[model samples]
Every structure is written in C-alpha cells, then in structure tokens.
Target: MDALWEGFQEAVRLIVRGDAGLREVAWRTIVVSGSATLLAMAAGVPTGYGLARGRFPGRTLVLSAVNTGMGMPPVVVGLIVWLFLVRSGPLGDLELIYTKRAMVVAQFLIAVPLVIGFTAAAVQALPAELPDLLAALGAGRLRTLWLLAREAQLGILAAVMAGFGGVISEVGASMTVGGNIQGDTRVLTTAIVTETSRGENANAMALGIVLLVMAFAVNLLLTAVQQRRRR
Candidate 1:
C-alpha cells in the first residue's frame, strides 16, 4: 500500500511537473494509435460494408477470417509484421522496421479486424430492406452507403472505440516493431515495460497512470461524441 501510494504521488508529480519523457511517450502513443485507428476505419468500414451487403461467394469464409483475426495474439501480429519489414524481406525496401511507421502498421493490422467485425455486425443489424429501400428511392451507391452508415452510426462509433482501445493498450506489437527507442518509437505501454524492466517501479507505475489517463481521455471524448449522436 505504501509503495502504491508513493507510485501514485510520483505519477502526479510527473504530470504536474510536465515531465518531458512522459509527454513524449504520451504524444507518440496518441499519434501512432490514432493514425492506425483512422486507417483501419477507412479500410475496414468499406470492407465490412461489402461483407454485410454483398452476396459474393466465400463471404462466409472471409468473415470467419476476420473473426479469427479479432482474436489473434498481438505478439504474433508483431512477429508477422516484423518479418515483412525485416532486411531481405519482400517489403524490406521500405525500411520501416523499428520505426513509428512500423508500429502504426502493426497496430493497424491489429485494429482492422475488430473494426471490420464490429462494423459488419452493425450494418447487418439494420433493417434488412434498408439498402433495397434506398436503392428503390433512386439513391446512388455511394449515397446509399452513406445513409446506411448514418443509420448505423452508433455501431460504427463502437467499432472506433474498440479499435482505439485495442491498439492503445497493446505492448507486444509496439515494442516488437517500434523497438521502444527513446524519443523515437517509445509509447506509453512500451515505456512502462522498459521502466519496470529497469527496476524503476515507481516510474513504471507513473507511466501506467499516464497511460490510463490518456486512454480515458480519448475514450471520454469518443463516448461524448457517441452519446451526443445518440441524442
């Protein structure tokens, strides 16, 4: 209990004193995770819509793959990404290994399936005739998609929250691909790991507090948006 209290105090001090390292790690975390979430949404939303609305063959198989991906281990995803970006790998020419971009890619892969699965479920839950009704009313394909998305906005927002949550809390993928380099690829999760490994328990706890706060802040903002939309 005493140690925990001291760690909390250290965390407060770190925040109150505007610790540079803490700020850097927090900002990097947001940027990398935020970018990845956005990219995943962009790709996943359409893929999900197609899966939900289209009647193509192998659709079931594809959805099963996405469901599997949602449960896939983060470390495995990191290893796969690392393999692709490593020297002598097919994509090695881009030299993305051990960088923030690499971390974003890994995190993006991690978030995309969750977004897709949630989005597909959301779209599927809508009135079965919604798409047909829109088409009968002469709505273009893009416009129909837009209307359906608006109708399913709540589920879509939930998808966004899930994606953000998954990527923000992940450590193995970020550490493996980002290398947790100081002021470079270091993020809150990886930073906490690094601090704990170095036996800086108080510092590790402080970073953990910062991470929790950051995650809460972002989720709070999203929740606000979600609730407002509901109203």
Candidate 2:
C-alpha cells in the first residue's frame, strides 16, 4: 500500500516536472498503437463489409480464420511474426526485427481481427435492404457505402476502440517482437514490465497508472464523439 502511494506521488511528480523519458514513451505508445489501429480500420472495415454482404466460395473459411485470430494468444502472434522476420527467415532481409516497425506489424495483426469481427457484426446488424435502398436513391457505390457507414458509425467507433484497446494494452507481443529496447521499442505496457522485473515497484506502478489514464482518456474522447454523433 505504501509502495502504491509512493508510486502515485512519483507519477504526479514526473508528470508535473515534464519527465522527458515518460513523454517519449507516451508518444511512442500513441504512434505505434495509433498506426496499428488506423491500418486495421482501413483494411478491416472493408473486408468486414464484404464478408457481411458478399457470398462467395470459402467465405466461411475466411470468417473462421478471423474469428480464431480474434482470440489467439498475443505471445503466439508475436512468435509467428518473429519467425517470419527473423534472420535467415524468408522476407527478413529488410532487417526489421526488434524495431518499432516490427512492433507495429505485430500489433496490427493482433488488432485487425477484432476490428473485422466487430465491423462485420455491426454491418450485419443493419437493415438488409440498406444497400438496395441507397441504390434506388441514385447513390453510386461510393456514396452508398458512405451512407451505410454513417448509419453504422456507432459500431465502427466501437471497432476502433476495441482495436486500439487491444494493441495499446498488450505487452507480450510488443516485448517479444520489439525486444523492449529502451528509447526505441519500449511502450507503456512493456515499460511497466521492465520496471517491475527490476524491482522498481514505484516506477512500475507509476507507469501502470499512466497507462490506465492514457487508455481512459482516449476512450473517453472516443465515447464523447460517439455520443455526439448519435444525437
């Protein structure tokens, strides 16, 4: 309990003093996780929409794969990415291992399925004739998709939050693929792990507190926007 109190004090002190290292870690966390979420949103939204609307051969197989991915262990995701990007492995000549890029890739893979699943569910819950109605109103493909998206914006926002949350909070994959290199690949979650392992309980707890606050802030902003849109 004392340790936790000290940690909170330390965290406040760090924040009030504008600690450089903490700022960097926080920024990097946003950049990496934000990039992953954006990429996932771009790819997953369309893929999910297609899944919900189009019927083709092997569609079930693809959905099953996405469903499985949504629940797969983060460590396993890291290992799979590590193998493909490791030295002597195929496509590893780019030397991306243990870098922020690698972490982003791993995180993107982790978040995409959640985005896809949520997006498909959201779109599926919409009226079946939405597309037809839009077309009847002289809406082209792009316009129709746009309108449908507006109607389903709430669910899409939920997908965004889920994807962002999943990647931002995961340490296993980030540590595995990123090597947790200080000033390079260390994120909030990994930083907390490192501090705790080194017996820096106050520092670890401070980082944990920062992480929770960051996550909550982001979600709060998203929720505000979501609610505003509904009105």
Candidate 3:
C-alpha cells in the first residue's frame, strides 16, 4: 500500500515537473503506435470491404488467416520480423533491424490483423443487400464503400480503437525489434519493463501511469469523435 501510494506520488511529480525523458518515451510510443494504427486502417479497411462484398476463390481462407492473426502472439510476430530484418536473413540488406522503423513494422503487423478482422466483421454485419441497393441507385464502387462505411462508422471506430490499444500497450515486439535503445526506440512499455527489472518500482509505476494516461487521452479523443458522428 505504501509502495503504491509512493508510486502514485512519483507519477504525479514526474508529470508536474515536465520530465523530458518521460515526454520522449511517451511521444515515441505515440508515434510508433499511431503510425502503425493509421497504416493498418488504410490497408485493412479496403481489404475488409473487398472481403465482405466480393465473391472470390479462397476468401474464406484469407478471412480465417486474418482471424488467426488477430490472436497471434506479439513475440512471435516480433521474431518473424526480426528474422527477416536481421543480418544474413532475406531482406537483411535493408539493415532495418533494431531501429524505430523495425519497431513500427512489427507493431504494424500486430495492428493490421485486428484492424482487418474488426473491419470485416463490421462491414459484414451491415445488411447484405446494402451494396446492391447502392449499386442499383447508380452509385460507383467507391461511393458505395463510403456510404457503407458511414453507416457502419461505429464498428469502424471500434476497430481503430482496438488496433491502437493493441499496439500501444505491447512491449515484446517493441523491445525485440527496436532494441529499446535509449533516445532512439525506447518507449513507455519497454521503459517500464526496464525500470521494473532494475528494481526501480517507483519509476516503473510512474512510466506505467504515463502510458495509461496517454492511452486514455488518445482513446478519449477518438471516442469523442465517434460519439459526435453518432449524433
């Protein structure tokens, strides 16, 4: 109890003092996770729409893969990415391992599946005839997608939340691919882990608090937008 109280106080002090290291970690976390989530949404939304509306060979298999990916272990994804980016591995010539970009790639992989799965489910949940109805009214494919997306905006927003939440809180892939290097790829999650491992419980707790607050702030903003659209 005393430890928890102390940690909470420390967190408050850290925030009040405008700690540069804390700010750096927090900002990097947002950059990596936010970029990954945005990219995932951009690709996943269209892929999901196609899966929901188009009849094609192996569509079931692809959907199944996306579903499987949603539940895939973050460490496993990190390992796969590391293998590809590591020296002597295929594509190793790019030399991207142990960098912020590598972390983003790993995080992107983690977020993409969630985005795709949620998006597919959202698009699928709409009335099956919605697409045809729009087509009959002479709407082009892009316009029809826009309308369906608007109609299913709630689910799409949820997808964004899920994708962002998944990657922002994850530590394994970030550490593995980013090397948790100071002033480079270090983020809140990895920093918290490092602090904890060093027995700096107060510092660890402070970082954790910062991470939670950051996640909450971003989600709150997204939620406001979502609810506004609902209105």
Candidates in order have lDDT scores of: 0.93, 0.93, 0.91
Worst 10 residues of 1 by lDDT: 1-10
Q: Flag clash pairs in model 2.
A: none
lDDT of 2 by residue, 1-231 (tens): 998999999999989999999999999999999999999999999998899888999999999999999998888999999999988778589799999999999999999999998889889999999999999989999999999888888998999999999999999999988999999999999999999999999999998899889999999999999899999
In order of appearance, the predictions have TM-scores of: 0.97, 0.98, 0.97
Model 3: residues with Cα > 4 Å off, grouped in runs:
none
Candidate 1 colliding pairs:
none
Tens digits of per-residue lDDT, candidate 3, 33-105, equal 9999999999888888788777999999999999999998899999999999998889699989998889999
Superposition TM-score, candidate 3 onto the true structure: 0.97
